[model samples]
Target: MAEKYCVENLAVSVLDNLRYQHDWTELQILTHSPVDDLPLPRPLISGLPPRRLYLHPDDQIEMLKSHPNPEGSIPETPVTEWVLPVHLAEKWTLKAFASVFDSMPPENSASPHRVKRVLLATVHDDSTVVYYFMHDGIVKPRQN
Candidate 1:
């Protein structure tokens, strides 16, 4: 019971940071998995970032082909992302992450090529949150 409360508090802190500090919009706390209707290991956050967090290699190529001049013309569409909040001291394994990935709905139902990924929000004791992208499988590295 107490542990659950702690986890919830951590999630709220991360959400607050994302909204106030990072300027994320349309944030939501998900208690149940949208895909399977099952309770999650911990609450998750979904929100639209201020800018696109990642662009798939294929997407970049397509954009270049369409635009021809890849200067400032490429549209930056912010997509909603799933966030898994955890304390820095917590232990996590591949199976744990796989469970969370399996529970998530597609990033965009209309786009069949999008990959399954999550933003791992790890909160430190000092109330600082760090984010890392976690893909379900190996993804092609984005071109520099």
Candidate 2:
């Protein structure tokens, strides 16, 4: 029998891959979203990475400036991952990604300070979910 295709299943698969392979924590499945104020083909995923993923340069500078001591300052909490979950059978476009991004909160809605970037978690038939970070706008090239 052929497998059923649904966002519920897709999200579970992606979450499994994240927990088993990347060791992400505090995962959540987000629903109740509207693409351009309407429904979508699927839902999205959110979670934490094993370590910090991206830190805004402005936020980093603010942290550095606000630290009481020059040495041994406390580190900021890692931001959550806003994931656009997809299945192997699905293909996406820039427009598709944009819709998802537009629908998402700047941070986790439950915790406004949590997430700052979006991630695409593409789940394959083989149960591997490849992740790539997405930015709302063009960013400066990284030093390395």
Candidate 3:
């Protein structure tokens, strides 16, 4: 039997996996009308993770110096992260990744020109998925 081939299907699969495994919330799929002339390879989705994924080292140093309450630290606000869903059978290259960033629909952008960083989530045969964080451009290196 052949595997199912639907953009929405693949996106949804990853979304469900994210919610279940990672405790991601407020997931939404960004759908765009096909331009015919200009087309993206896959649909992009965004969601909020339970904790911060990217934190600046300088901020952390400041926080440590200030000495925050550790027992019940309340997060100021949660930010949504982007997701690029791909099937387990699919293969991606730099060109493929560039294409996603190059022509991402405005719906994915937080502002007019701001392109959000994405999490590349790949769904497997057993409905398990692996994720990798994908940043838009060069950024300051974070501590390990």
* TM-scores vs. true structure, each candidate: 0.87, 0.69, 0.68
Q: Model 2, 1-144: lDDT tens per residue? A: 234577788888888888888899998877755223455435777788888877666666667778888577447577677787776677667787777666676463465442346787777777777878777667665422
TM-score of 2: 0.69
Q: Write candidate 1's Cα lDDT for 1-144 as tens digits.
A: 224238778889999999999999999899887766889777899998999998778788888879867676688888888888998888788998888776776666685444468899999888889999998888898776
Off by over 4 Å in 3: 1-4, 33-40, 56-76, 105-113
Prediction 1 TM-score vs. true: 0.87
Indicate the residue-level lDDT of 115 in model 1. Answer: 41
lDDT pick, better of 1 and 2: 1
Say what the RMSD of model 3 is: 4.9
Clashing pairs in 3: none
lDDT of 1 at 103: 70
Q: What is the C-alpha lDDT of each candidate?
A: 0.83, 0.70, 0.71
For model 1, where is the 10-residue window of minimal lDDT?
Answer: 106-115
